[model samples]
Target chain A: MEFYQRDRTLQPAGYTPIYKTSVARSPRQAMLSLQGSLSETTGPVFGQNELGPLDNDLIRNYAKDGDPIGERIIVHGRVLDENNRPVPHTLVEFWQANAGGRYRHKKDTYLAPIDPNFGGCGRALTDENGYYFFRTIKPGPYPWRNYVNSWRPAHIHFSVFGSGFAQRLITQMYFEGDPLIKECPIVHVIPDEDAINRLIAPIDLNGSIPLDTIAYKFDIVLRGRRSTLFENRLEGN
Target chain B: MVQSLDYLKETASQTAGPYVHIGLIPKQAGFDIFENNFTNIMADENTRGERIIIEGRVIDGTGTPLRDALLEIWQANSDGRYNHELDRQKQGQIDERFRGWGRAGTDFDTAVYRFETIKPGVVSGRNGLDMAPHINFWIVARGINIGLNTRMYFADEQEANATDPVLNLIEQTERRKTLIANRDDSGPVPVYRFDIVLQGENETVFFDV
Candidate 1:
């Protein structure tokens, strides 16, 4: 896999122009939402929260508190570089549909009515070492326009926070072979060769374990050299 | 330089800061534009995701990621729709790409992060008008928590930005700083890299909250 090293000198085509504009309050307000103790060294802070609204689908199944299904994935891992160095105290969050493709939020309407047995969202906070995770269900692929023919693969959404306001990233993760990969407009936006091998969930069909207890592990590596970059497993064509 | 650094440090404690002056951001690169890259908030994944390679380093005023510093970005989906339950359209159809929201944290040396997402679509402005494509960004650094309600537009989007109501609101001089549409129709993925600095050189940016 070849990597496109950015030539800082080389410019992007028709990039958006910047115009001077006045804003409401000062930028100081930006950091207000965070909980930082000035008395403390400005190190990373990790946040924890209970599982969000269990969607109708997740509800159908009996939810036991300590069950592995309910047992927190404890998504604890460090965001490392190609060299495996830790990126300090960054902010992280994730959201996905219930196991059945429905969201706990009021936005979605694609899947069949409701399974009444799923949880749609979870959030994680990284400790001083830049790591965070959310216990969440596998998001399902749904249909939309912009692309003449296609639906996105079931996947999770991740947002990484950093340095300046523009230092942010929002992207999706797909299950290996979700069938919706081929024509996704976002996937279409990239040349097939340049697109990284996508990450996907392996099926636990044989079920060496009980039906209710199942797990899949996926690792995420951010923008880097393609050789070291994880391949994007295309799905849902 | 060392003496001045110390002096400025003392001053920052008493001063109003660049955000109050409103004059400092213009001198720096990666300034703010009301329309484009980081602006719209999405309700869900499909219509509001921001998929792009965000590469840069953490540095003190000299240039760096503040390696230990953290960054957060939130925006609307490709269809210019957010995943918020309240943002439902008149048709009762939840906005596509409104994958509502998402977040990622930085690693020890990992200053850069990227996402695979479709480009966002045009959106309705606060004034009930049009806006160019953009993503919203929230950056957290040392004592600097800059909220930039900015946007990143494509270079070839001249025709689009021209009619964009938000872009039209600004005066021409400031407009160039806000809009980042450089004419690079030939590059790969039509890259739009916007790096931010917390203080000094190119200071971190701020928008009207």
Candidate 2:
């Protein structure tokens, strides 16, 4: 059991026709890579009796009477694995667009304004060393049609998993100094500027909470597993 | 295992956009904030074998049908094992009433995506070879900037999809009929179908796992 493959040059470039819906959604053939079997070294565990102590609290999980108007933050990090190890218990999930970029979704017609005490989304899990956090509110900058003024930057959409199913990922975090993450055409279909600076995130005033919330961090790596035998137990799960 | 010149480099993938169902199915975008939601029913009437259903449609490249995708699947349980703890620590069997993982979504007006699960058996692969029953999908949507992986096999297994070492690693035997899936026993159970295209002409073969 030694799987570890994904690094398609740190991905993103499957027909980046300036990200206009990636021009008919990429894939003009030639993908088939294979090798990691047992369905890519197995995945799907998420226990903690299937979450919900407000599942990582997206600012009170879906508050209605008071708390969800803007700038609260948190985010946090860890889930590592390109050999920096620590992938422990993994599943992260997240979602955004409130403080005013709007998106309570019914196809977000934009024009920002839906905060009836926001309900954006959340979920966490990591632990046993691979940390995880959540909290939320900061989400704004949105406007997309991919280019007649395409704006999207205050990101946050995670969705990790990562303890193999080929360490699934689904990214988007960006927020450090967002110059719209350098004019994102979907973050310029990553031709890697250090993999788009590891999807941004920064601002961690020592995991903030000074006068209530404001942190950021955002680490995540996922896709690396080795085994050979540490008393083998079925590829050392 | 030496790698790590300060490891970390993986992140970059952006575009589960058009509000990915307000974050992966927030009660299918109307947000009831998940109190146990993710469904497509991964087996239940006391879980055990044959059942089936699967159905599909992720289509795209002008053929339309993507009602914002979002799939997820993983299989095994109907005896080829895997409810995973490395196959329950090497097959000490498990079907603790099966929930072999599912999560479906597409149908915000029929971009169709069904699951209902069961039919999984034959597993083993790589060196031990077997692997025919298949299943494992993963998809993701809104202009999908990443997350695609595939595999669904089984058109009545046709002699185990012809010695399926991941369909003999496709080297184009008519593009391995884009990972089979046909079946259709007309109703009550066995459906299969499996569409997933994502780009020009017969696409669906995606896997880089």
The prediction achieving the highest TM-score against the true structure is 1
**Candidate 2 backbone overlaps, count:** 0
Q: Candidate 2: lDDT of A55?
A: 76
- Candidate 1 Cα misplacement greater than 4 A, ranges: A1-78, A115-119, A127-134, A147-149, A162-166, A192-194, A198-212, A222-237, B1-209
Q: Please compute DockQ, using alpha carbons, for every candidate against the native two-chain complex.
A: 0.02, 0.24
| Worst window of 10 by summed lDDT in candidate 2 chain B | B84-93
| Fnat, one value per model | 0.00, 0.67
Residues A1-237, candidate 1: write the lDDT tens digits. 221232212111111111001111123223212111110111122223322222112222224352212322222344433223344555554445545554443334565453343433334435556554444445556664433445656666544433222223344455666677664544333222223243344543443235443444434433222242464631101
Q: What TM-score does chain A reach in every model?
A: 0.53, 0.35
Docking class for candidate 1: incorrect
Q: Write model 2 residue lDDT over A51-135, tens digit each, in one string.
A: 8888788888778899988899888989888778788778888888898888898877877789887788888888988999988
The TM-score that candidate 1 achieves is: 0.38
Best by DockQ: 2
